[model samples]
Target: MAMLNQVSSQDVETLYFNHHGWLLGWLRRKLDNSFDAADLAHDTFVRVLRKRELEALREPRAYLCAIARDLAVSHWRRQALEQAWLETLATLPEPIVPSLEQRALILETLEQIALILDALPMRVRQIFLLSQIDGLTYPQIAAQLGVSINVVQKAMVRALMQCYKVLYRGG
Candidate 1:
């Protein structure tokens, strides 16, 4: 059992030697940026090492591809979010624009909020977005969605609870 759990440094080195080039090439084709591809390839191996599932992997390439794919998707989402934020900032007056440090902090917070919001159920997320982003009152949202005000209120409560748990309680 102990042997089943333990993968030696040599094993990791062998795995990297065997698959690194293939993984790098896969990422390069997927990302169209050699630098980002290289970074994701390294991140994939780091994830593999941290997981300590080397001995259990029946198909190393498939496992690597799955990790790399998730990383690539997250990379793309973050890039899109940053681009949107930058465009919004561009519309602001120069004097009111955030400093570089403030911008980074805001971006990070937005990413966390996006992740939280994405985890919400479809109806709940829709209600939250309508209320927050569209500035619609509960009655307005209920009318728009053809749901009762009670249902909309309940969904908002559920969504806010999810946010509270994840953001405040670290759940």
Candidate 2:
């Protein structure tokens, strides 16, 4: 067990030292921004270090590349969502006015919440969103959906589970 642990620790350290520059270069090629690439490279190493077992990795380079790719995709998706949200907010009426910074912050929070909601089942997502965002009480939501209060509670629990999965699993 000691030998295995030492080998794994050495392997991870060597992997990081040998490939850190290459990983940053790869990210730069994909992202076209040195600062963003650096940030992604740092995040990738953080993720690898947090994993439980590095010795079991058959292809460390491939795993790290996948992590970087996922991060890049998430960054792109967030940017797209933010742009769309800004455009939507720009057209809103004066009654719901929000400042530019507030609009950005709200969009970011909404994006995160929406990602959590996306993991939920359709009905559960709708029910939870109605309760939290629409200000509908459990009993009111139950009545509107023609379900019992118990059913509404179960749906809320299910929705919360999905949110936890997304947040904790980093999905």
Candidate 3:
């Protein structure tokens, strides 16, 4: 078992060595910063090693590249979300201003929430935004939508379930 583990480790190391540069280069083409590309490349290898069936990856290079690409897209999305959050913070009232560190924390949380919200269907997302962000009650929302209270409650529950699924998916 020890020998088998050693062989597996060696295989993963070889895979990383052979593909890290190519992955970085691929990421660099899509991203502006070499450091960011390198970071994503390292993350890709980390994810690859954690997989239970790395040996089963027939086209390892392609698989690794795909992982890196997904990471790159996620990075871009997070950055965009953070920027938007910062802008929103800047527009808040002076007494409600957040410190720099607090702003970062809030941005991170909002990004996670945004990701959860994005997974929801369009009407579900609208309902959730209206209820949570706009602070609308079920009866108020129901009246606004011309739906019954029970329908609004059901929509809220569905939206909440979708958010929970996105949050707990271990992405």
Candidate 4:
């Protein structure tokens, strides 16, 4: 068992040595950020190691690229969400605006909520945002979205369940 573990470790080292530079370069070009590319390259191997199936990866580079691409997409989505959130904050009433320290805390919480919402379907995401953030009624949401109230209700339920799961995942 110990010998097997050592061999497995050696295989991962070999894989990293062979592909890390090429993967980093590719990701750097794609992301246009050396730091993020390096982090993603590291994360790709970390995921492989976490899976404990390095030996099973026949197309290693392809596997790495796929993971890297998904991570890149996730990063971009988070960036977009942050930009939208900041724009929304900028338009808030001065009286209701949070203090600087409170704003930081709120932004962090909003980022968590964004990640929770990220897993939702596109329509579900839209409906949930409309109802929760814009204070839309079910009928209003349905009309705006061109769907029945029942469909809007179902989407709200699903979106809320996902948010619930994310919020209570540790519990």
Which candidate achieves the best lDDT against the true structure? 1
RMSD in order of candidates: 3.0, 5.8, 5.1, 4.6
TM-score of each: 0.84, 0.59, 0.71, 0.77
TM-score winner between candidates 2 and 3? 3
lDDT string, candidate 4, 1-171, tens digits: 212232266777888999999999999999999998999889988876776443455687997899889888878876777788679888999897778898778767877876777789999999999999999999999999899999999999999889888888841
Model 2, 37-109: lDDT tens digits are 9999999988777776555566667878999998888778788888888788779898897887897788778
> Each candidate: what lDDT?
0.90, 0.83, 0.82, 0.84
For each candidate, how many residue pairs have backbone atoms clashing (under 3 Å)? 0, 0, 0, 0
Model 4 stretches with alpha carbons more than 4 Å out? 1-7, 53-55, 80-104
* Per-residue error (Å), model 3, residue 127: 5.1
The alpha-carbon lDDT assigned to residue 162 of candidate 2 equals 76
Q: Which residue window of length 10 is worst by lDDT in model 1?
A: 1-10
**Candidate 1 runs further than 4 Å off:** 1-11, 52-55
Q: Write the per-residue lDDT of candidate 1 for residues 1-171, one digit (tens) a residue.
A: 322456667767888999999999999999999999999999988887786545566787997899999889889989999999999999999899999999999999998888888789999999999999999999999999999999999999999999999989997
Q: Tell me how candidate 4 scores on lDDT.
A: 0.84
